[model samples]
Target: MSEVDEYLRFFPYDEPYDNQGEAMDRIHTSLERGQDVLFEGACGTGKTLSALVPALEYARDAGKAVVITTDVHQQMRQFVQEARAITRQEPIRSVVFKGKASMCHIDVGYEECQVLRDNTRELVDARQEEAQLRERERQLLSDAQDGEERAVEARDAVVDELENVAERVQSISSEKNVCEYYKNNLTGNVDEFYEWLFDDVRTPDDVYDFAEARTMCGYELLKEGMEGVDLVVANYHHLLDPMIREQFFRWLGRDPDDVITVFDEAHNVEAAARDHATRTLTEQTLNQALDELEETDDPRTKRAANVLRPYRDALVEVYEDSFGFGERERVGDNWEDVAVANESGRDDLTIEFLQRYEGPGYKSDLEAAVMLGKDLDDQYEEAYKNGETTTRKDCQTLQSAAFVGAWMREGTDEGLHPVVSVRRDQGTDEVYGRAELYTCIPQEVTRELFEEVHATVLMSATLRPFDVTEDVLGLTNPVTMAYGLQFPPENRRTYAVSTPALFSSARDDPQVQEEVGTALHDAVRFTPGNTLVFTPNYAEAERYAQRLRQQGDATVYLDEAGVDANDLRERFTNDDDGVLLTSLWGTLAEGVSFDGDDATTVVVIGVPYPHLDDRAEAVQQAYGKAFDRPGKSDPGWTYAVEIPTVRKTRQALGRVIRSPEDIGVRVLLDERYTQQSRSDMGKYSVRGTFPPEERDEMIDLAPEKLKFAMMNFYQDNGRYDGPPPAP
Candidate 1:
């Protein structure tokens, strides 16, 4: 009908969906118009094609090279796989840009770096805090007419906590058990918070806790970092947080804004943004700094003291107002915290806030506040600014506090939570309150972030109310596009079966567990072949999977030790004959596929929804006030729950009956679906075939029975899609 439509007809893809067509048109128009595009398609819509097809075609038309990169080797390979479909149309050449550290020797130089210099200042701050702790201890010792008992008791608590956490560190992995060279092997449980702080180390148990380890270990990402790339897929951190961004751009010194960014599994953006905002302070720093004032004599140490003198006043003010100004600090037995209720400057913060606090556009207000404790060209400007003075004070209190305010720095024993300090690892808990983490919000909007890029496209199957992702992710003002695949129910039999089991929220209830087991058994039997049971939550999934395994044969329930989803997929793909018991958090629930004879029955256990997430909790609270306010539904939950559920459902359903001959049953077990007049699944919901009254019978349809029915339906409906992409 049109030149673009005509061009599409010759394209190798057999059939496309409503969203896919819309997205392609928008993408084509954007490139033709010479406007940058930020296409936010949901997962599964084949958005990769929307960007890729245009990239390849453009490369040929313009006689230029095309480079494409995703987050990892697999992702890059996925793009290469897509390129083959159109390889006949245009030749493709690509390369993987990996960080030097990926190969073994780390390329990051630690000597004479401005960043490392800042790190040195951290040690100086820590030394100052240590001095204060000594001062507090001396004060407490002087007041303890109660003798060593009180001091010993307080001191022991802190030390004991450290010992307890050290005991809790996990032993070496099972893979290392057979090695004669097995190194440190510590077992048994201990206090984790203590080790994370006093000792300040990130162990394997620290995977999710300290974010610093994730950053260093993720040094693997740099191996793939660099430019002249067509598409770059990365975590939200790469583009948003400043500390991560600075190093991120180091590997690829070229304009990072040149390539398009596509966030896979993008619902996590809000958390990424909030993480950009939290700040913390350590109790150790307060204690140690008091000690340092009494203990240190060097000009360097005194200089460090002068810088902290003001913040110390702020702390004393908060403390005295809360605790009624009492001068007593010492190891009461360790782990003793004494905050005063009324001190010299306790009321100063309110004064400071009133002097600041701008409404609505508060970013400028935040900027002005940061300028207060920073190095100004004019020294008098520093005095008038708040606490600005010489470069030394400018370096510690003023500059540090401003840095903390803008970047939201949270201090700890090691300074920064869920992030480890590389500087403090120099043996002994030497530097207290030394921050290992540095996170910052990106000033650039997604559009502004990539304004320098020439052309781009983004697509996914779950792109609904598409504006949600676009607006939040800073992609709002871009040429919008949508491309979809044929999503109608296939010759495959689909059922929405209700389970009798009530979610126990209480795990110890055996009867509830049994009911889940029974439901899983009945659901799994409908197919003449292997089945996959999908649980919305990890605990519930594992519980049911364990229950099923008790009466099982050829069932594979993965170990509690979390395995990467891809590895699990390979196992599922290779061993399609076995029943796969997978949870929402694990691999089987999303991304990977289980189809044809390998999986003939798919059992969805519950309505996947947000249960517990602080960010989500905060979003619901804030968004409620931001939108409807006081009394209303959450805009956050609608996106977090409804949207994610729709995406999950689409992913689970996609797993079964790959081809017409390859038939299977997809059973959604939640009653929540039945309660609604229509689910967000829209036409993809099971109602198009089975009447609500006969919904249970849909489960009985099974693979053998459904294939015959599907053959008849196809006689009338025909195949919505012609064939699968060639392997």
Candidate 2:
């Protein structure tokens, strides 16, 4: 058998799908050549197995470990399941690393956890020292004879020292500030736990349950057991965040060169990278810092707070000027302004303004703030140890100081934008100032990571337009593979209807919304199972939901901000024919499966473009400056806006059909998608943005005919039982 066939033995199935086999072969080839692979396979292409099988085979032979990073807990659990299947065939060890907060048995925050661990370590060290002294004293007493004066003196002195040490140990043991879980982990033998962890592939939940029963720290066990593991699964932050990545690699005891990394759902890498790099300092944070300082008796901390006070005022002034809150009328009951505040409250603050503002000494004050914050942090720890406080909250003063320091250091970096915004308290209409340093370019974080790793495989169902991905992510000449949808073409139908484009200018027009809503109502009524509607934003989602509730017979569920999505998903999935109305870039749009009879239709109301706020405009301008050329037509908009929007639309489309056995209908309720010609499509055309396979399957029809076509489709698929609905 060939090398690819050999790898297939660990595929955990009798036979691989055609796309799966092709993907495996290509990924294996890329790995062998020491090149990264960008694999784009549709929903039914067995992405997890295809990526894992080759990665495992290559890593096992190359004396490397496979590090798999996902975007959600479900994906991580899926990885664990796949790893277990591979383990049954070969005895490879795999472990899942969850965040410390999740794996911790105690109900404390991150800073508290650190404090407890520190105190526990001190106690354990003191006890060990006491034990050693007692052993020495016992030996001395045994050796000293009744007549030997020098030996007797030595024995007596050692006994006295042991008693003092014992007292210290007792004092430490009696302290209530230590983490018993961490203490147990430090003192108890974990060889059996390690053996059990390595015996089979384990999920984070499994590790948590086992460790909880044994009264041990699961995070510590996973950290210590990483030496010989063949595969590791973790969330994106474990690999994206710089400090966390450093600690993660330390646990693995391997350099980037010794590991093969796979970024599942790799389209999210850009956003994840940006999120990790973004920093914000709020007015409340500064006030809390002042509060902390006021409570402290130390003169140094008080002086630091004094320095911070003026800086806070300066920051607020910047926000006020940037947002023009003083100039605008405070229309309390204006629905539009409220929506604007709820949707895009941020306004641009030029880097030059931040650099040139002379109201306060930004650089000097911020630097001093950092130093003072560190001093205050040390003082707080000292106080905690002395039992001056019942509990220790995180030092917001230090946090604020660090944020300002970071802004000062990296604010002017290309692709990083400074913005000021206001937050209105819900209980009271009081507005507070907030500042953020947004990282617009994923390349800032991902370029170094991908370059340093041995090889990376970025697989997603919608990671198309390789040029955009490569340029934005700063990938070198990597192998690219795009596979068509593996499911039967007959099982799926996509229609780009003839409704007027719901562009920002036309979305509020009652005529356009009614037509779009009418098309969705029909689609929901005709689809046998559940239907999912994806809008451009929450405002649009709510508008369409109202229309559907008024006109359609199906139960309409709307996704609201700050609501628990899991509960909503459970309710929707349990319904027989419920319509879930949500926006793109939400929980339901990606990393969620609506397989089987859960959802039979997904309706995209409009092209889900990035909100055109100050940040987005700044990013577009930055991309234009970075990648624009004389002959290229709007490369910046294409890269920064259009491509990502198309990816979100496709992510929503992929939600309904998860396997070959699943049948689904996709509706694009806008004329812009169908009006574009493949030959002369503009940079902003939604249809032009789609991958070729998706474009090929799309059929354009008038809005009134959408329900008829859907009805015909369901009937042809043997799912429709009732008569054809009126269009």
Which candidate has the top score in lDDT?
2
Candidate 1, superposed: residue stretches over 4 Å from native: 1-23, 34-46, 56-73, 83-95, 98-104, 107-403, 407-456, 477-488, 500-515, 562-572, 595-598, 627-633, 657-662, 675-727
Give each model's whole-structure lDDT: 0.44, 0.81
Cα TM-score per model:
0.55, 0.89
- What stretches of model 2 exceed 4 Å from their correct place? 145-157, 160-164, 174-176, 291-307, 318-362, 385-395, 425-430, 561-564, 675-681
Superposition error at 479 for model 1 (Å): 5.3
Q: Write the per-residue lDDT of candidate 1 for residues 159-220, one digit (tens) a residue.
A: 55544433322211111111111110111122342233223212222322332332232222
Candidate 1: residue 188 Cα off by (Å): 53
The count of residue-pair clashes in candidate 1 stands at 77
For candidate 1, the per-residue lDDT at 170 reads 21
The count of backbone overlaps in candidate 2 is 0
lDDT of 2: 0.81
